[model samples]
Target: MGQKKKEIIKSFLLTLAAIFIMFIILFPVYYIFTVSIKPAATLATTKIELIPRNVTLDAYREVLFGFKGSKISKNFTGTIEGQAKIEDGKLYLTDGKITGAIKYGPFTGLKFEIPVSGIIFDVSTTENFQGTLKGEIEGLFVLTRMNDDGSIGFGIVREVELTSGDVNGVSVSGPMEKYVVIRNTGKAEFTAVGKFLNSVFFGYLKNSLLLATLTVLLSMIFVVPAAYAFSRMQFFSRDHILYFYLMFTQVAGGLGIAGLIALYGMIVKLGLYDKLPVLSFIYAAGSVPFNTWLLKGYIDSISPDFDEAALVDGASYLQIIRYVLLPMALPGIATVAIFAFIGGWTEFILASLLLTEKNQPLSVWIYLLMGGIGRGIDWSYFAAAALLFALPVFVMFMLAQNYIRSGLTVGGLKE
Candidate 1:
């Protein structure tokens, strides 16, 4: 065989292998996307489906917005069965029962009954009196000035809780509020209100975004100056300090459950538990030593002649770092920022250990979904949520792909 023909065959074989490896790597992502689009009911089938069947965005919908059945009832009428008394210029109602009919659009005439205690209203001779509901449906209510016939106008200004009870044949729950109006003879009307987004999912997304953003900012703030100092300045024990940072990188890998336990105890003692900003700081701290070293190397790869030139021009050290080094080290900085973001965005163990439900990030929530392993796992919803969770990191990598490549490679060439 000719040498060129052999080379062509070798090239073909390498291309085939590359395609195969690419397929192997990307199949799981493709499968996850398919699972996200597939209907929940279809995910339970025994057959392996390479192609999704019965595609529906219901999972994504549920992940972004809560259940589709959530509704707000506009018309509710009830009677107040307790007497109102004035104390300290405030009107109070105790041991009251509000029994009424609520109409939630298509779901009409639902029985609305709630026990009320210590409901308070501010006394006002003109305009309206503002009151607060403290029962199952808690909110502020406003009563307009009495008309000439002695009837009062009323409406709810704000409600804080979702009503949990059976409304006619339907179960009412999850992120719904109520608006109420009180009329003559203790008759009150309520309008049910609903929030659109799924609080849990959005909360997790928000926490992740916040944590990632803070990690990047804090990491940059802490890492860049230290890295620049290490790269540029020489003082006593400078090498020793750099070695210690390198040593910490290795030691950190060995810190397992014991370190986490210690961290948990310390966080609880310091009253910093469940705080996302604190978590961000922790994430930034964890990335610092390695990132400082990495960035230092990238900075080192840039000739020190730039620093000398800037100095010759009467530029201060800070000015040299700002004007001379940073612009050139952007790739390294981006690389560090990306690392910090990924660390904060994807950290499950520390987040789970330190954060309560309300403060937990998406990673913690996704890990908790594994609790449904033995039980019926909602693969569709899980897939959708997981995909959404991974998107920010994926986007960061794609956006900074070139910088990351250069940052990781060029750093090693110099140091």
Candidate 2:
């Protein structure tokens, strides 16, 4: 072949190789996604299917809502100011002020009016205690029966303002505080992503978000100044201190169970065990050394000429760093933040050991999903949880990817 033809062939081959590699890498992820949606009956079929023959979101539902029971009763907890008025034997709630307070359950936005038409089997309550009143919602049909009072029951009840974004066919579980039974017995089955999100798992998600963010903020606080000092200043035992940091990083990595237990004991003594900030600080402490090292390398590559210029302009060392070095080191700072966040986001073993049940991060739940591996286990749920757990990390990385790439590559530039 001629030169141009040969180059074209080479490019074509490289493109094909890249496509093949991408397929090999992503096929398993796609398969897992399919498996996660597969119905319970077809979860362990002998036949292999790239596209599941039957797909149901019960696993994801369980992950989000933590309620796999047939009943779909959810509790709404908050302060309310609305008056429920009875109109034509139908209860209608109007002008209600609801405060957001969810001690339990994933109902952060449980604001609504009980539409007049929603009141079925309308029986007037002498007590205005809507707190634990039970109501049945029959979206499909009306059930009419004679009560002890010899009155005909109003058969069908429906939400006039059905959730603009309601789960297409959420299951009706056991009775709620107010007998608001959602009878979805004859409805079309659909994904319960909404149900899952409005669950306790969402609390775990919130906890992880808080921890990871605090870890990043705390890591920046600890790493930036130290890295700048190490990069720009020459103080007493500076070299020794840098070496000590390097040693600490290595030692922290190699710390075994004994070290963990000792740390646990110290946490107990300090009475900081199971606290979110304590775990965040621990993550930041571990992150600082590596992040400092990374930032130091980036800072070193930027000449001290900027510091000299700032000094000539009557700026102090701190001012020079704040104005000049910090702006220049934005990418490096982002890289460090990414590292700290990933450390906290994915740290399961340490979190489980140090945190309480309610305070534990999503990492604990992620690990629990895989605990049943190698047994009569459902791998689909594990896959789903793993994917969801890694989603935030993926998003964080995407947000900071350019910075990380540029931060690491700056050191490789020619003078």
Candidate 3:
């Protein structure tokens, strides 16, 4: 009974530990997502918010498609006049007339007299009325239903362009902005930015994909054969060589800036600087030692009887590796593939140093978005891009969780 109680207590503690760990892991993701959805104005607040206020998709929209700003096109401008009247909570412009010159395009400074109507407003309150202007000259408008004297109405033209009308038996209309007053006039304001596909972000995405794919392909191609040979072959000094190779992984990051400088010098000397393929090769080469050791350990767990049987059955070593080992070593291979892809995708320093603007990946481009000294960072856009950048890796990890677990464990254990 005591043992069972102890086991129960242990299970509860383990569960609590897992929850704590998961919270630590996932909190940043939640924070990033919240920040991505928050409005730009709210990003600088000192208070921490697990749930962001003023949530909007503007950041995502801006990142995916650039902010196409709003401006009055110089090509289009005009004026119109009419009698405005209000009845039963609705405002109507009666006998509206476009009296003067409409400028730009085919109608450049051309005089046109046109009878129009239907600038109607659905008056809901004292402040403003929702309205549309439809006639020989058509538009949408928002206007104050009540004037000071309750006679003249004032509003800006929401749209008054490209309406077909006959001027001396000529069908004519160009894109035009106009202001109309039923006895008096004023201006209305609308603020919105247009959107266009962000080619720059997509370009970075393409380079990142290319770099990651090439890195995976190169890493797998080299690591598999090397790992298989190390697991199967009994060549002299093989253990010494493998250990020597594995030692580099521990010291690789420890080399710091000095190491990067040396690497840069080597690249320049070899004439391999600024080449993405060379960068991919470098990434693959850096990871090969650890990947080879991991995969070899995995392969060692497989029985050697299969290799002998294949040899006796007239199958070559290549065929045995292809037909037998590869099929069984998929989990380890997947682990290696994931490692290679992530290394390629997220290695910012090497990418920044080795690649030019034309080949810069998302990782480096995102860093550039931070803006240099004294310029403040746009956290909303940054968060959106970061969330998008991490999504693929997160999805891959989730999908391959079981394979990764199996591959990382049950290796280096020989009975």
Candidate 4:
């Protein structure tokens, strides 16, 4: 009865610990998402609110669309109340006109009105301005009156310039230039903290995926053959050689491999410094020994009966290996693949050393974006990207979990 009670207590403690761990892991993810969706002003405040005070989608929209707003304006030229003649589809100012009219159309009517300044001139087909007018035309056109009764100035009116326009038509004078205002439309003011987090998060995720896939492929290619040869083939000093290879890998740490890279530069002269493929090759080499040992154990567990029987049926050594051995070792191969992929996905040192700026995998990019640069880490995007990057590995593990377990257990138990 006492032992039963102890087990029950242990189970309860384990459950509580698990819950705490889950909470610790999930809290940051929840917070980043909440903060990303919150308004920019609320993010700036010292007070911490569990729930976002103001929610806005402006940040996402801005990222998708460029910040520049389209411009629309109305131009007015000619006499206000005067008769103008159209000769060859061109308006000509005449002396009989009492007033000239110029009209600008198709104003965008954006919320903010912008000040206008620049030269505007009407050019003749001969590339000459009929008249040039400078200074401010409040509405659109500059008006001039002739001393003679019922007569207005007539010629090719060259240009009209507006020195100032209106902000929502409430008159203001300044140069015509672009300006952006981030307005707080919410009930409360808020600040956005999404920039860094968004960049780092996505960046790392991409890096992890690329690293994992390439590592798995390269590691499998090298490790499986090495394991097969070590386990199944007979050769002079094979056992000693395999043992030496395994022990050497165990002793040669990652930093020691830097020397090898330097040697490769001296010998091959390939100029492979800071290359992604070189990094992948290094990762593959590092993972090979352990993965080969794992696979060799699994391959040995498989009854040689399959290969022997295939040989009896006119199968050559290569044919038996291709057909019988590989098919039987599928689960083991998958286990090695998963292990290699995970190792590469999380590897930072080789990735950092070998990759350049544009080609740096997600891991290096995330580091650069987070803490390597001047402003420091962007936690929100980093979190979001991390979760995304982890999702696929998690799914892969979940899917292959049964196969992995079966493969690991294959040689251990004799049924």
Name the best candidate (by lDDT).
3
Candidate 1 residue-wise lDDT, 370-407, digit = tens: 68764388888888889998988898899899999999
> After superposing candidate 1, which stretches have Cα over 4 Å from the reference?
41-46, 67-198
Candidate 4 achieves a global lDDT of 0.55
Candidate 1 overall lDDT versus native: 0.70
Specify the poorest-scoring 10-residue window by lDDT in model 2: 163-172
Candidate lDDT scores, in order, read: 0.70, 0.64, 0.70, 0.55
- Best-to-worst order by TM-score is 1, 2, 3, 4
TM-score of candidate 4 relative to the true fold = 0.56
Q: What's the best-to-worst order under lDDT?
A: 3, 1, 2, 4
Give the runs in model 3 whose Cα sits over 4 Å from its true position. 1-10, 41-43, 67-198, 372-375
TM-score of 2: 0.67
RMSD of 3: 13.9
> Tens-digit lDDT track for model 2 on 1-415?
5999999999999999999999999997787787777765233553557768777887776676553322222333322233444334334443332222212244242222222222222333332223222223223222222233322223222222211111112211221122232222112111245335545577689889999999999999879889889988989998788879889878867878878999899999999988999989888988888788888888888988988999999998779878998899889888888888899888988899998887988889777656665645676667677778888878878878899998888844645
Clashing pairs in 1: 73-192
Deviation of model 3 at 224, angstroms: 0.5
Runs in model 2 deviating more than 4 A are: 2-13, 41-48, 55-58, 65-108, 111-198, 236-240, 371-378
